[model samples]
Every structure is written in C-alpha cells, then in structure tokens.
Target: MAPPLDPEVLRAALVTRGSGWTEVEHHDSIGSTNARATRLGRPWVVVVADHQSAGRGRLARRWDAPPGRSVAVSATVPVPASGAGWLPLLTGLAVTEAVEATTSLAAVLKWPNDVLLPSDDDRKVSGILCEVVTARAGPLVVIGAGINVSQSRAQLPVETATSLLLAGARVTESTGTDLVVAYLQRLADRYAALVEAPVTGGALAGPTGLSGLAAEYRTRCSTLGRRVRMTRAETNGAIDVVGVAVDIDAEGRLVIDGPGGPTAWAAGDVVHVRLDG
Candidate 1:
C-alpha cells in the first residue's frame, strides 16, 4: 500500500503563484470527486478524494478503489461547447503524460478516456470522465480522472486494470502528489491554447487550430493503426462497428474505416481487436 496523500503538501504546491488554480480541496473520503467539483461550480477549482464510495467511470460503470489505493481528482474549467468533444481526449493525454513524467511507467492512451500500460499487456492504469455543466457565468467542463496507484494484482476490480505499483512504478506520497500537480499544469496549458483557437466558418483550422493537438493525440493513441470494435447506441439499439481506426478528426472524433467505408464517431466504446491464430 502506498502512503496516503499529503494534503498540506499538495495545497502548498498547487496554490502557488500563477498555478492557474483558483481553489484546491483534498478529501480523505468522499462520494465522488466529480460530483463535488460540479457542485463547486467554478472554473479552475480542483477536488480530490482518496476514497470514493460512489465513484463511476465511462457509461456510469462503478469504479471503486480502497482508501488511498488510487488518485481520484476532478477539476472544473470553462470551455467552448463547440469544442467540448475534445475534453475527454485532452484529459487522457494529460494523464498519460503526467504518469510517464512522474514515474517509470510508459503510458499510452486508449481513445476517449483510458490510460494503458503496454508493458502490462495494455492493462488500464487510469480512466477519465468529463462533464459539461452550466453555471451562472457560462459553461464549465469538469474533468475527472481515476488513477490506480497501489492496488495489488488481487485487489484490482478487473483483470484489465493495473496500478502504478503493479506496473513497477514507485509510489511515495510525494510522487503521488507530483503526478496530480503535473497533470493539472499540463491540462491548464493545453486548455488555454485550445480555448484561444478560433472557430471560423464552422470548421476548426489546421495547425493553428486543433490540428496540432489532434496530431499529438493520434501519436500517443494506441487505438490507431489497429483493428478495433466500436459499440455505439443508435435509435434502434446498440450496434457494433468493426473497423480499423484510421485517424482522429479535427473535431476529436475517431475516424474508422470499416466495411461501409469511413465513419466518424464523437462518442463510443472502442476496443482493440487482437487476432491470435
């Protein structure tokens, strides 16, 4: 088991000069960081909880971690509704970057919201969820991230999930705090650039627009250049689209080349297909 978060240390580091943070709150136990962050209803407010009694993941799936076994944090920030689709992708990229920089783990993104460790057979180390909330000021995006920190193999909720300790990354209390600080800093920098990117003629621009970010996401994404299955819900029911993930479009949709040609999906569950013969 890793040491519990040092709340005082975290506050001191994050509330420093020009950290781009308005408020930072750390909880020893909470229902959900995302829920609390949304209620906070302010931009640049970060809420972190060591234990979530009612944590949830994509598609409202329950995500539970024992006390101090994971890093659960949520941050609210203002973002354009037009570019809202990019929040999850941006958060995933930021998490992987932070984990890799703070520890000895090589992390990669699995489309929309998962951070995976290839060394561990693509097991997930972190999951991200973004929610757009309307406040008196404007629209704010609450980005929540759950990172497995010190769970043993037996303690993992699923066989596909692994923690920093399980993946051979040392997890001291300071290191854990460092990871959170790093992710917040990176997310703030990228979000600032993304918000300033202009929207003209209803199309995002290239390079100067989200193209640079799109390109970066593609490079870090392990879903590209692989056969995959995408489950999407339609008017009728949920349908599975099997295809090769070709690219991430300018608007942050996944472009899949399948039997019916190419289709772009804004939201769906993506699973990489592995063929063993």
Candidate 2:
C-alpha cells in the first residue's frame, strides 16, 4: 500500500507550476470542487479530497470510491481570450497524455469528458467533469478529475469498476499525486497558449490545435470501429449506432454512422456493443 498523502510532499511536487492548492480531509463530493473553485475565482487553484461522499459522473451517477484509495482533484482555469469553447476537449487531451506518461497505460477518451481503459478486460480508470461558472470577472471553467489508485475489489461499488493497484499498476502516493499535478499543469499551459493566440474565429485554430487533438484522441479510443448502443433519458429506447469513431466536431459533438446512414448524436449515454443484430 502507498503511504498517506503528505501536504508538504504534495505541495513540493506541485511547486514547479506556481499554482495555489488546498487539500481537505474529506468532502461531500469532489464534484462540488468545481462549484467551490468557481466561488474562489482563482486560476490554477485546486481542491483535493481524501474521500468523496457524493461524487458524481456524467448523467448524475454517483462516483463513490473508498477513502484514501483514489485521487479526486478539481482545478479552475480562466477561459481563453480566443473564445474557444473547446477547452474541455483540450483538457481531456492533456490528461490522456499525462496518464500515458505516468502509467504507460494506453488511455482512451470517450466522447466529451470520459477517460477509459484501452482493453475491455479492464474498467474505467479515470473520469473528468467540466463545468463553466460565471463570475464577475468572466467565465471560469472548473475541471474535476477522479482516478482510481489503490483500491481493492471489495472497496469498489461495482464489479465493472477497477483501480490502478488492482490492475497491477504500481503507483505510490507521491507518484500518483504527482501525476495529477502534472496533468493539471499541462492543462494550464495549453489553456495559456490558447488564450494568447490571435482570434481565429473557429473551434481551435493553428496547425497544432483541436484538429490535431482530435487525431490523437481517435487513435487511443477503442470505441472507434465498433458497434455501440446509446441511451438517453428522454428517449424511450436505445439507438443503435455504428462507431465510426471519427473526429469530433468543433462543438465537441460525436459523429457516428448507423445502418440508416450518418447521424450526429448531441448527447446520450454511450455503450460499446460486442455483437450486432
């Protein structure tokens, strides 16, 4: 088992980035970090929790994990001056890169803001939640991440879930915390660059922007080239869609092709299918 998180140790690991961070013993939920950070209105300010009582995911699913066995952190970043709304996508790319760098695991990104494992044999290792908060200064975006680090099977809520330690991936407390800090730092750097660039009036301009990001995401995504079913709360039935897993458009909408032809699903729950009807 990894050692407990030391404030000094975590702070030291994060000092290189020059960002303010706050650690808490326990939180009602890490999902609330975004809201808390927004009220603080400080860029690069982070809120971390040892345990989340009411953590949440996409579609309001509870994201509870055993205390001290996972990492839950949230950071707020100022919106880029370029007016690019796709900053969340950029954040996802940064996380994917960081996870790959630290664990050497092939991290795949699901549409919008989910980071999944490359193999079906494994469960989701990480999840991202992005929320935009309007303040007197302007729009501040809070990005929250939850990662499974050192939990066992009995500690998890579902059998379909997994953790880094359970997967035989070695990650000490220092290394795991450092990994989260690194990803946040990288995300801040990318956002800073985007803000300084001239307004191109598109999703992400330049040769090395969102378009390039999409390309990288496509390669890591296992959902591509497979058949899947999407269910939405409003819909009475599931929609069968073939996973072309192509590039996401500027607004971060996924493009999929079904037997009926081509369709763009704006929002829904995505499930990969093993067999087709």
Candidate 3:
C-alpha cells in the first residue's frame, strides 16, 4: 500500500508556490470519488481514493486498480451550463499533462477520453469522465479520472492498460502527490479559459469557446490522422462505423471521413486502427 497523502504537505507545496487549492480530502478506500464529489455538491472540492470498490468508466464500464497503485479521484468545478461540454476535453488534456510530468513519458490522448503512454506502445495510463449536475446555484461539472501509478507487471487489469511505474514514472509518494496537484492546476487554468468564452449566441459550442484549445487538443490526440473503428451510437444489430478520424470540429466532435462523407460523431467508442497513409 502507498503512504497516505499528507494534507499539510500538499497545502504547503501549493502555498509556497503562491498557489492554493480548494477543499480537498483523501480516503484510504471508497466506492467512487466521483460519487462522493457529486454528493458533496461543493464547487472546487476534490476527493481522492486509494481504492474504489465500484468505480466506473465511460458507458458504465468498470475501472479499478489496486490500492496505492493508481490515482482514482474526482473534482467538482463550477462552470456555466453552456461550457459543460468543454469539461471532458479540458480534463483529458489536464490528465495527459499530469501523467506526462510525473512519468517523464510522452503521453497522448485517444479521443473521447483515454490517456496513453508511448513507451508502453500507446497502452492506456489513465481514463477520464466528466459529468454535469444541476443545482439551484448554477451548474457544477464533476470530473473523474483514474491513473495507473505503481502496479506491478502482474497487477495490470487489462492487456491494453499500463501503470506509470511500468512506463517509467517515478512512482514515489511525492510523485503521486505532484501528479494530483499538477492535474488540479491545469484543470483550474483551462476551466477559466472555457468559462471566459462568450456564451451568448451558442458561442460556447464553437471553436471560439477557448482560444487555441481545439488546436491544442488536436496536437495531443493520437486518433487524428488515423483509421479508426467506432461503435455506433445507434445500432442496427451490432454494426460499427469504420473510418479515418480526421479532425475534432468546432463543437469538439470527432470528424471522420468514411465511404460516404465526413461525419462528426458526438459520442461513441473509438478504437485506433492505423495511420492513414
């Protein structure tokens, strides 16, 4: 098991840097940090758990890693209703950066939310999910992420997944804390940019929502310029849509070119196939 987080140390680390964190809590075990953060209803509050008994991923898939071997956490952020759609993309970027910093690895994103370490042959190092909750005060976006940290070779849950330690991350207590702090800082900065975007006239849904945010996402996205197989949102039987992922449009949809034409998908399971030569 990993050492428990030291709140005082975390607080001092941020304060000494002329930065500060909002309410934060750490638990040795929990059902899900996202569930806890959502239930708490406190903006900027963060909850982290060493182990989750019932963590979930996109489409209700299970997400779990051994205690102290990963980062399973969630945070609540205040955002305008119009900016809710941007949270997932922004969080993906934040997690990717944090993993890269902690691991000293080139981390890339597989769109719609997986973080990969190239040293692990593009194996997944983290996953993210963003949710919006309505409250009388306004809208709150709850973001959850799980990052594999120090799992032994035999402990990985899936063949496609990898831990930071396995991918050459300096997996110490301080390294994990740094990873968490880095992610929170990045999220706070990106969220500010997203909120400052013009919400009037549906501007929040366009590329104008955040200056250069789309381009940045594109640069980190491994799906772009690659052939992909996507599970269709609407299925007639089990048919899927296979195409080349070419872009992330103004509204953050993955634009693909198929046998017919370019179609922007708002939601689906995307599997990276190969680069389109």
Most lDDT-accurate candidate: 1
Assess the local accuracy of residue 4 in candidate 3 as a C-alpha lDDT between 0 and 100: 55
Best by TM-score: 1
List model 2 lDDT by residue over 1-277, tens digit each.
4444455655665655345343322243354655566677766677776666666676767778776787777787666655355566667777777777777576766665567665436477777777777877677777877777788888877777777767666686575666776787677766766665444664455656655555665666666666667778676555545555554665566677767766777677777676744
TM-score preference between candidates 1 and 3, better one: 1
Candidate 1 C-alpha error for residue 64, in Å: 0.8
Tens-place lDDT per residue, model 3, 165-196, is 78876667677778888888887777777877
Give the per-residue lDDT of model 1 (tens digit) for 1-277. Answer: 6676777777787777877787899998999999999888899899987788898898777889888788899998887645667878988989999999999989999988699998788899998888888887688888899989999999899999999988888878677788888999888877866776677778655576677777788889999988988886452335568889998887788999999999999888888989851
TM-scores across all candidates? 0.94, 0.83, 0.90
In model 1, which regions exceed 4 Å deviation? Answer: 206-208, 233-238
Worst 10 residues of 3 by lDDT: 12-21
The per-prediction CA RMSD against the true structure, in angstroms, equals 1.8, 3.3, 2.9
Residue-level error in angstroms, candidate 2, position 99: 2.2
